[model samples]
Target: MKVYLDNVGERRLIGRADVPSEAGPVWIVRLFGSALIIKEHYTIGTVTHVPDGGARPLMERAVLLARGQPPELLPGWQALAP
Candidate 1:
């Protein structure tokens, strides 16, 4: 799933990471610009953004919606993940 955060002029390309689990799959997100590694651990409900060069982390609470349910977005239209 790709998430476009137009409010901040950023885009993220996400894919499932290789892990064994029945709860929820871990996701690997690549943020545009800068070498920031973002990982979403669904079981913990947290999104961690760690920037390179020893910068501070930017974390946020994330909600995982079920398949076929799209995440809320702003006025601009967004493509629903399939």
Candidate 2:
């Protein structure tokens, strides 16, 4: 995931004060090896200020949550359903 993506669907570095509203039409996931997926996409984003392992591990936790697995959510987070 590009942490610096601008809100207009472009990949450019933005300041920390600038909030990002959009993520990607393509995402690069690296579980064992890196692979790019162009079909599935994320249109909106929510920011997480996890300073421990950064975004990757947080994303992994999200996967577990999706699969009804353990390792509950961190504080300041709520599971919302669409």
Candidate 3:
């Protein structure tokens, strides 16, 4: 899925990820221009642990956005265009 930094003056195209259909809440946290995106993955009949305040981690990706890139978004979450 196409990701973006939404706290800046102009929206910045950060990066993307391959989130599954059963992916739950997508949590993103940023600091000093760096960000960590955590996607909850699960199946229809499967169970998974949630990312708690103090835990190892779940399936996630760390994206470092460029400080000079312009903000843009794709047409859809699973789209390749930007």
Kindly list the per-residue Cα lDDT of model 2 for residues 1-82, writing each as its tens digit: 2233433334332222211324333222223333453222222343433467555433210111212221122222233333
Worst 10 residues of 3 by lDDT: 39-48
How do these models rank on TM-score, best leading?
Answer: 1, 3, 2
Q: Give TM-scores for every candidate, taking all chains together and pairing residue i with residue i.
A: 0.27, 0.18, 0.25
Candidate 2: C-alpha lDDT: 0.28
**Clash pairs, model 1 backbone:** none
How displaced is residue 16 in candidate 1, in Å? 18
**How much RMSD separates candidate 1 from the native structure?**
15.3
Instruction: Report lDDT per candidate.
Output: 0.37, 0.28, 0.36
The per-residue C-alpha lDDT of model 3 at residue 5 equals 50
Predict model 1's lDDT versus the native. Answer: 0.37
Best by TM-score: 1
Q: Candidate 2: RMSD over Cα atoms? A: 14.9
lDDT of 1 by residue, 3-71 (tens): 322223243433332223332343333334654654322221345688998899987443333343233
lDDT for each residue of candidate 3 in 1-82, tens digit (9 for 90 to 100): 4444534434344555443444445323232343444322211122223577877655433222335333232222332356
